[model samples]
Target: MLIDMSVTPLSADDRQRYARHLALAEIGEAGQQRLAASSALIIGAGGLGSPAALYLAAAGVGRIGLVDYDSVEASNLQRQVLFTHDDIGAGKAEVARARLLALNPRLAVDAHAVRLGPSNALDIFRRYDVVLDGTDRLAVRYLVNDACVLAGKPLVSCAIHRFEGQAMTYIPGRGPCYRCLHPLAGDALVPSCAEAGVLGVLPGVMGTLQATEAMKVLLGVGEPLLGRLLVYDALAMSFQQFSFQRRANCAVCGDNPTITRLEDDGEATMIEEWTPEELAQQLEGARAGSLLLVDVREPHEWAAGRVPGSVHIPLGTLAARATEIPPDRTPVFICAVGGRSMAACRYFAGGGRPAINLAGGVTGWSAVHGPLPRPEGCQS
Candidate 1:
């Protein structure tokens, strides 16, 4: 993933603007020149992209492409620093370009205000030296990985969920790919930041790490995070590293690669079928008022501001007492946050029962409705 170096030297103002970068022994004049030649395509203009794009632009990556069709919302401002309150309701890609150019007008910023699909991925990818995956969805993660593999480019991937963040760089033939780590994940649609709440500052940490890795890869300066998976727990203030290797049978990068291109027919399982906003919308509608609110948590948990009329059925006893559940009422399963409730929903839904997981569960519910009221005699 070597960028074509620019023969054109930095202007006087450019040198002044990047004096700190020029002062660095490792990333001085030569490294800055290489950065000015490199191109990076960031595939999501949200959490991870916000910081990464800013750093790349500030560092003077010649061409920065942002691909996203989503519009900015008030919710995005929690972690998407590139967008201010004024930028809300504007297209994320276009708005990101404006912010980046404002930071470094010399660099070229391409805004693809269109969805990243199989049809256009390879064509767009070929124009960049490296691809950064800022997207949170598993299916798209797979698509981006495969696209990078085919287009012969390196991918820096970072993801944040709840209090945890993970990052790894996938250099073609250099180390294990994303598929080598999680084979079955591509066939599923994991919850987005919208459904699963993230700590406001978590992506900021991970995205900066991604920017660091991207710079390292482009500059060939230090050891890149190619084979090592870095994990950060913000709550615990801890970072852990694990080693992984390329699989011999990886579907895209294997000896006899099976997947030549992206296919459209695969069924992706939704990690969260219902979000808090969606549930509220459904409740406001006609039919779901009779829906059963099943609280699948421990007694102590249920005593702590559980949904008022939810049927109490602890997860451990759910299987034994499955028959006791009223079949007529469509069950809206819930737990502390979302993990346990989604598991319960999947189990019940597998049996052909009408079951939906309360995304973010009670924590999500409490965010909207405040502290939920406990059952009449359950707690003071």
Candidate 2:
């Protein structure tokens, strides 16, 4: 067993409560007892944490810690299955604690109704055998992974975006850490679920997989996702596995590692921004001829509606079509929201071109000027 089986002997009630687990040959009495002795710390009591918490609690995990500072909102009812209409406006961690206790009164649930920061992450992580990273924020993801490496604890990290999601496991000295796989300095340029959108049932599927991996890690019964990434697509209803390797120069878990302490990952470099009102004022001023309005949204979005004098340069094709942009005029990038445009701005700025991002993209512009003008043949 992964954990010490010398834990308190299972009572008649535990045997009855986990009768199903006890029946499985892989997770018989000893495995169930191991589960009963193990503890898990789950960050973010939102969509991913909801199902994982429920299953781990019902499966007899002795202790579970939930970390989140936000309160439940009405929109959370769609994917955050741990809360209900009555739970709206309630603290997420506390509500999740109550729900887990109600599911299984034997286990202990710790509700950390505060944000997880570098100062407190290591201390909180040391108490748990494993960590489940359910947070959607990019910086927090790196913090959890790095802290686990420093604390020598196993981490089960999962992320969902739109219709797809990915899960991976990291064990100290066994495999690559999150930084080894994603060497990028920051991931904030990637839009969040709210900035984009997600299928209501997506996190449910991924979080359950997270619970499955956590139990396996506790039981030491099956091969964990160590060195492997599991990607799931709800639209295609398929799963794919990609293998990764430990980097020799990885900053967190490498032979000559540089990062020996916990710190927040640096955010994307700040670029110049222009509000919709500023763009309008510039269009009517003498500098109107000196600006090149570049719409970096997808072709579909561009076809629907766009600014009158803007040029369509999809983000995916922008890098290759750099020559198309005029050298004399300043380029102002715009997208559906600001994320893709920000990325475009950074790209041009890296090439020594002074670029600007529309603060809120087409949505912001439309909000200011009533509605954007559409193409003659556009369907939307």
Worst 10 residues of 2 by lDDT: 263-272
lDDT of 1 by residue, 1-380 (tens): 55786547888998998899999999998888888888999989989999999998988888999999878978789999999999988999999999999998888999999877777889999999889998865446877998998888999988888899999998988988888877643223232323457898998999999998988888888988887999999999999999998888988888878777765313223223566778878777886766777888778778877865688888777778878877777778788776666656656654657577786688878877788887777646
Error of 1 at 212 (Å): 0.5
- Whole-model lDDT per candidate: 0.81, 0.84
Model 2: lDDT equals 0.84
Q: For this target, which candidate reaches the highest lDDT against the unseen true structure? A: 2
TM-score of 2: 0.73
TM-score of each: 0.72, 0.73
Worst 10 residues of 1 by lDDT: 185-194
Q: Over the stretch 230-294, how does candidate 2's per-residue lDDT look in tens digits?
A: 99999999999999999999888988877787743322222457788999998899988988999
TM-score of 1: 0.72
